[model samples]
Target: MHKPLLTTDFLDRARRHYADEEAVLAVDGTRYTYAELGERADRFSAALQARGIEKGDRVAVLDPNTHYHLEAAYGAMQVGAVHTPLNYRLTPDDFSYMLSDAGVDAIYADAEYAANVEAIRDEVPTETFLTNDADAVEGDWESFDAALDDADPDAYERPEMDEDEVITINYTSGTTGDPKGVCRTHRAETLHAYLISIHQEITDDDVYLWTLPMFHVNGWGHIYAITGAGARHVCTRGVDVAETFDRIRGEDISYFCAAPTVLNMLGDHHAEHGGATTGDNDVRVATAGAAPPEATIRTVEEEFGWELKHVYGATETGPLITTSDAKRHFDEGADDRFAVKKTQGIGYLGTEVRVVDEDGEDVAADGETIGEIVVRGNQVMDRYWNKPEATEEAFSERLEGYYHMGDLAVVDEDGFVSIQDRKKDIIISGGENISSIELEDTLFEHDVVSDVAVIPAPDERWGETPKAFVVPESGDPDDAGATPEELKAFVRDRVADYKTPGEVEFVAELPTTATGKIQKYELREREWDEEDRMVGEG
Candidate 1:
């Protein structure tokens, strides 16, 4: 029998199986049961419908990870409305573009970002602005909680969800031009959640911490999987290393995912206190976007006493097509062990992965030949919203049938995938293709660089060259703490001389997008304004 894929159905199942079970734990230590979550979601859905939001309407949600965010998401999903989750850290301009492009009819924002919505609210297609309570700021918007206060608690009976009908329209972290909306359906989200659980080994016994924002690929598909498994959810509004550690101990958090920035913070916290004792910490950390450096991975395993699983995918790909936790045949301490942990492993069930040369021919899986990565599956997104040309560009211009990942990679004989570099981020210096990831990894080895981003610079003679934007660890910004020349020499000592940055720019901190990803495209624009192509898209 075919099981339902819509999230409301999963909520119904969860209510039946774990009605009194705790579904969400707030930061202040309040708990909401699965049954309560469903009722609250029903009230919110009724309130939304009262405001004229109906099936197929687009409702944009912008907030930190919280209990209400989950309720709003489930309510939106239940009504068959397209849920558009925005990065709460985005600028007014970023929000404006996404809202106008997605044709958002309503928006639910937290108080901290109410001004952001106000700045562009007139231009957006939305009038139903629902702001949640935070430190109060005056706005003419509806109170998020108060709206549900008077609404009927009775559950809504909307049209049944079609697996093929669009359920979400997630915007990518745009480093270059406007962000593209990746439209996904019920089948894709539900199927990908199952894949994430099996690959990450999540079950009912696990207690998940929401460190990753729910807006990103629906919390990377864990929202569905964890709910299905009847797991407990601990909600957090922000990431603080000490608070994270305390929660892991106090709440007994078993699984979570965050960017390497968050992981580094936790490692620093551990170093300040006594490091994690063996088998004392019972948490699993999964990271993605790009494979973090090997040292960061080893630190979590050795110091935090946690197993770090690395994977890679983009917003357009449903973000679970590749992972690195597949069972291995080799011994534990072998040199290849580090290599295997670094490579993005085989595809999830029902997904196909391949690497091909520029000519569209499959490359040998010898772990040496670098080529573009491609995938196609049921979990793949349906298409870009209102964008036929962009959708066409995504699936073609490289391969005939596969969705071109645009990331350059290679596969080993055992079917493990290693990212050589991004084809777009490569530096063409003196006619050499220098991998920016290689240079960034080597620079990270430097003791002075706290955080670093590598992009390309325009060269009159060479056409393009690598440029490093570095953030040093030393506290004072006026000390001339770490010079660009020093960083170049640091890289020169390790990698080939040609791979070194032609020039390094020192900054107090590296700029990151709302999602905690280093905004390489903004840095790329500063260095490559005169050139036709960016070293990385800024």
Candidate 2:
């Protein structure tokens, strides 16, 4: 017998089998069992129904990595409403656009971020507004806890849902333009959770730390995977290096996900504090957003004694179609393993990842020929909500039926996919292709460089030359400890002379997204602002 794989099945399973077990350790130190969490979700579902929210209606959630996010999301999905999560770091304008575009019926905003929503109350279609602390917010928002307390848990009836029905609408980061809502079916989400559970090695006994935001691709789909595994979630409002270490030690966190920038921050904190950052438990950290340099990976695995799994994908592709955790390729604790883990690696089970050329043919496995990465997987998003042209363009650009990732990569002889740079971020200087990622990675190896971003700057002679933005270890550009010429010579000695950065600017820190990925587009915009057109264009 085939059963529909609904997203609500995860919470139902946790409530059934792990009812009395600890489900969530809230940021404020409140402990909740699966039974309690499930009941809370049910009450929220009742509250939403009382507010006139029905099946297929959009319910937006704007919060940090708190327990409220999980409750709100599961509550919305339990009643078959579309679970729409918003980045708390976004501006009022961003929320206005997303809420209006999604036609959100109700929204649960965290007390800290409710002001943003309040600022745009008149612009959106939402009528029901709730916040964790109604007293803290200066608006007509109701208390989330008060609503739950007033509602009966058994009053709401769950509508029948099919696996093909859209249940979640994740908004893109909108780096290039207005954010588009990515429509994902219950099948896509359920299958993605299962894939991550197998690849991430999540277990019932594991304790998961929430360093990654729940707003990002549903915390890379961990909200369901960890819950379905009967694991314990250790929630936090935000990531702090010291707090991360403390939670790992105190709570015995076995697994967590973070961007490479967060790993770098932890590494720096560990370096300054010595062995105090280590916990008694063996930790497994899954990192993405960008490939971690070999040096950063070495620090995480060798020094911190944690397993580092580098995965890759975009928000439109389940954000986790590929992983570098394949054990058959390299021996544990070997120096060569870092090189293997440095690549995006092979695709997950049942996922088809390919590096294709302009003609949609697979590139040679020479690790030198750069091509765009395309994927066909059950976990990929179905389409962009209300944007038919963009949806068609995404899947039909490189290969029909396969989603184009817009990332340039290469495959080694062993079929490991290694990303080089974004399609638009690749620098073309004097008829030569230069990967900004390669340049940044090289600069990251320098002793004085704490963080770095590389972009193509407009050059009169070469059309476009690489420029480096370096965040020094001293945190001050004037006292960076290394001259620009010395850094230029350093890269010149390691890579091809032409690939060396033509200009180097030291900064306090590189601009990063809410998820800790550096915003290279911001740097590119600054460099090409005066130019009429970007390089490699007529």
Top lDDT model: 2
lDDT of 1 at 246: 74
TM-score of 1: 0.80
- Across 158-224, the per-residue lDDT of candidate 1 in tens digits comes to 7777888899999874333456899998988888887888888888878899988889888888778
Clashing pairs in 1: 521-537, 521-538
Against the reference, the lDDT scores of all candidates come to: 0.77, 0.88
| Weakest ten-residue segment in model 2 by summed lDDT | 529-538
> Can you tell me which runs of candidate 2 are displaced by over 4 Å?
425-538
Q: Against the true structure, what is each candidate's TM-score?
A: 0.80, 0.81
RMSD for each of the candidates: 10.5, 11.0
Clashes of each: 2, 0
- 176, model 2: CA deviation in Å? 3.0
C-alpha lDDT of residue 218 in model 2: 96
